[model samples]
Target: MRDANREWVFAQRPDGEPDMDSFELRESDVPEPEYGQLLVRVRYLSVDPYMRGRMRDAESYAEPWSVGDVMAGAVVGEVVESRSDDYDAGDVVTGNGTWGDYSVLDADSVAPVDPSIADLPAYLGVLGMPGRTAYFGLLEVGEPKPGDTVVVSGAAGAVGSVVGQIAKLNGCRVVGFAGTDEKVEWLTDDLGFDAAVNYKQVDDYGAALDDAAPGGVDVYFDNVGGPITDAVFPRLNVDARVAVCGQIAHYNDEGVPTGPRKLPQLIASRAKVKGLLVGDYVTRFEEASEQLGEWVATGELGHRETVVEGLDNAPDAFLGLFSGDNIGKQVVRVSDPADD
Candidate 1:
């Protein structure tokens, strides 16, 4: 049904970190879905640090890829045509889609989203995987309580935004760490975080954290697992919890470097540090969605997206994530699905 197509495939392997040439855009036939599948025109494509791991051949939670394949990430699109009863024409949905304009997917693979509650792009951000990541990682794993002080690194990104808000909802005093002062302002100003530290501006992270949260951290939401996390590890209160969500800072590292050991922090604090994958909480997606939607509807929750126009800018937008160029959720507007 398409007259023109431009799709990006992994062009070359990255040596240390990825660059624009790592992806190649080429023309192709617009794909159509088969039975139990829906043909969707991608509207918005998400950019996340977890995607960095996918670019590597190293073993991780998800499978790695060979060269000359479409890189995978979350995408929100409109169903132009459907071979299943689940979706109809013009229905906006979000799911695992490649970096392409138009693609076919099993209807079961994507979740139907209602635009009445929020925008379609939000399904790929605050109300989607990042939402679920924050929901389960905080409540289920970190177990924040009323009056607890919660501290989250990468506080301005997709998952961190929701994590801070949810912590506020639970009556916890929230402090956050971000790469820039602007992000720090957004966290404390718009997101209801009590205190935020611009990590780049701070000289000693441990001291700055102490100044922000004089009571010590009760829940540690670790996103950047390098120095920022190392600083927070020693500040956890007795019986405190830590949710190890992401390590964007180290994604580009050629090799793991040794640092000052903190075995004593682990024992003395008696803190629980747990690594989580969003897929593990698949059963609770509906529950999390319902609550997040309710919060959004009530205006208790908010999210931001750094949208990059055009499909061609996808690689640059993704590349900017490591450098802290995005404010909240990073997305590429591939094509206008409404025109279809």
Candidate 2:
């Protein structure tokens, strides 16, 4: 049995973009599970754009991570020891655990993970939060119809990638906006998107979006909300649905940055734009998970993972999200599940 634990904590709040100095890694003694707690041996930890919001000392849907607190997110781990009747030693589980090698968490906080359905790391990604985000945000909020032109921003990242694929599954003509030519090709070739634009290479984003979505966008899934979103507004069709899942472009801003006043476009097009949070559909998670799992199991959906090995490298994996360094879901493999 392991006797030591390593943890990453929020050292300081970032200004614009976070750096290595923002985190502090420390070693500690492994914790014991209490009556209703289980000792988890972490295998994989998720790194996401939403985590950037938690770094700031500001008010948001999720509370900000206080300085010196263990940075936390979705984690997949195995039970090294258990004091709860619900779990046993060697059971694989997933929950909102910390960025640590091991954690003693309340038994009710975690859900059993079936390695038979998907790979272990997948529980932190496609079979987990990102998949749920895409499912509800695209279907419930975007409400795409058959043959509609669907435009998705950040179309190559975890949630965005799933959003585009789900749009295609709904019989929509999917157009994607991504950072690089490689991501564009992955979207168009591997992911079956009708069209994809490299936003970074395009001289004119508006013209590029116009070319990709000639019929005018009927559904817009906005993940990176900034200029790409500004470009999409003018192309919205009447009664179009826009699912605002994220604004990653603005997550690092020192203050709220003003952009094009595009409410007039909404008025002219009679479009519907609403923000989405996956947690809102907690009651229907099983429905979404089953469908997403089926899609994964049947090869209808392709999922990718960009992994950084070792728990000490977790901060680097997290920092990479802002710079588009990952192809799909970004996760840190703390250790092999069988290592324990």
Candidate 3:
């Protein structure tokens, strides 16, 4: 076993957008597992936008990270030392873990990973939280119906990609908004989206959306909230359902963000809008996981991952989320499982 561990810590709070100064990497002793915990060597570390919210000191759905606290996220790793009967030394697992090379996790909180299902990193993405979010958020909150025009903002992202594909499976006409032409192409060509607009290139998002979704949006799955979202509201058909999955556009704002009044439009359209958090569906996680796994195995659902090479670059990978630097899910490769 290694004598030392390296981890990232929340060193400071950002006034607006975070920079390298916000984090500090330090070395420490490898923690010993308690009676019900297992020491696992992390192989893949998941970097998600939600982690940004955790950086703030204010109250929200997730607990805020205090300065000097070790950063944590979903990780896929191999158990190296076990203190419980539920896991063995060689068993691979996934759970909430520290942003370090090794983490001490409660055995009950970590689930055994099946490599046959998909790649290991995939457990942090398509067959993981992001996948579940898309499944429940779109199906339950958005309530898509056949022939309905389903529109997704941040459509090339981990959750949005799945939402669009699931909408297609339900016989809905899917349209997506992506940052790059390449992402737009991937959505329409490979993901089977009926049409995709590159929001970055378009001078007027409303006009672009009109061209793609002329029938008016029946279901809007919003992941990036800003001008793109403002454009979507005015185009919503009566009885439209909106799933407010994320508002990444304002995550870095220092003060309250001001935008066009959308409540009036909502009243006119009689649209239902609801915010979603994946944790709300924890009771039915197995149901979603089983269905997602089946879809993946049958090639009915497709996924992609952008992996940064090392833990040293994890911060860079995370900050990239704001710049739209990744397509699909972004993860950091900490260690190779073969080395274990």
Comparing 2 with 3 on TM-score, the higher-scoring candidate is: 3
| Least well predicted 10-residue stretch by lDDT in candidate 1 | 255-264
Off by over 4 Å in 2: none
* Model 2, CA-based lDDT: 0.91
Error of 1 at 145 (Å): 0.8
Backbone N/Cα/C clashes per model:
0, 0, 0
Task: List the global CA lDDT of all models.
Answer: 0.88, 0.91, 0.94
TM-score of each: 0.97, 0.97, 0.98
Tell me the deviation in Å of residue 40 in model 1. Answer: 0.4
Question: Candidate 3, 118: how far from true, in Å?
Answer: 0.4
- The candidate maximizing TM-score is 3
List clashing residue pairs in candidate 1. Answer: none
Off by over 4 Å in 1: 337-340
> Ranking by lDDT, best first?
3, 2, 1
Model 3: per-residue Cα lDDT over 1-340, one tens digit each: 4568999999999888988998999999998999999999999999999999999999999999999999999999999999999999999999999999999999998888899989998899998899999999999999999999999999999999999999999999999999998898889888899999988889999998889999999999999999999999999999999999999999999889999999999888999999999999999999999999999998999899999999899999999999999899999999995655
Please list the Cα RMSD from the true structure of every candidate, rounded to 1 decimal place: 1.3, 1.2, 0.9
